[model samples]
Target: MNRITLVRRGFVALALVSLVSLALVACGDDDDDDGDSNGGDHSTGSATIGDIAIEGAYARESVTDVAAVYMTIKNSGAADTLLSVSADVGSEAQLHEVVDSSMRQMEGGIPIPENGEVTLKTGGLHVMILGIEGGLKAD
Candidate 1:
């Protein structure tokens, strides 16, 4: 074959290899998303532990073995609620509170009052994961 013909064949072969590689990479990305497609940002509906209804429960970055899981606990019944949280990874998990003292900035305030509600988010009282599995995303 002419030199020009040989060069054309080589270019075609390279393009085919590239296309296959791209396809393989795409398949791998899908494997990472099962019920966790949101990358831990969005939510997976309500998480019911016993009678308590945990609304808007979610975590970010599954790769992080220790994730700060946050949720809104809604007490629907007439009586007040006193509850605690537990994760298999952490040795001890406490129900924290964030308060703004007269001097210091807002931080882990006091323990949740009896039948009181608390929000664990950025710069607020959060679930202290004493230990973690891999990496915990504080964000």
Candidate 2:
């Protein structure tokens, strides 16, 4: 085993570990039958922001550096958009949608049509919290 070969083996091992971590993060709880994945006591209830109401705001306990936030957004007034999401628990918050069994970061904002509602749930549209500080504790 030469020095160059050892270095290449090390790099390969590191890459494999990274890929496994990413795969675990991408695999969400598919058995969440109730849409919400956080189970009981995770909800923050409902909050009204102008004509837009956000309900069932919750996040599942994170096993890694990322967690997804689920909620229901209802717009009773004119059409609007969810430009972004910010939280003190994480360093980066991104809007993502599940496409073909993969989570894709949504560019721009998610549109909220008038008199319509959008549900962010498991295996659907959600807010991904990356670089979670102190991790997400289940309460």
- Model 1 CA lDDT for position 79: 34
lDDT of 2 at 137: 54
Question: Candidate 2: where are CA atoms >4 Å away?
Answer: 1-42
User: For model 2, what is the C-alpha lDDT against the true structure?
Assistant: 0.56
lDDT of 2 at 103: 73
Candidate 1 lDDT (Cα, whole model)? 0.34
Give TM-scores for every candidate, taking all chains together and pairing residue i with residue i. Answer: 0.45, 0.69
Instruction: Name the best candidate (by TM-score).
Output: 2
- Check candidate 1 and list the clashing pairs: 65-135, 66-136, 97-109, 98-109, 99-109
Error of 2 at 73 (Å): 0.3
* Candidate 1 local lDDT, 1-139, one digit each (tens): 0000001111211111111111111112212211111232243234343333445544444343333444555434333323444454446445444455211222332333334444545335444433555543323
CA deviation > 4 Å runs, candidate 1: 1-40, 49-51, 62-66, 101-118, 137-139
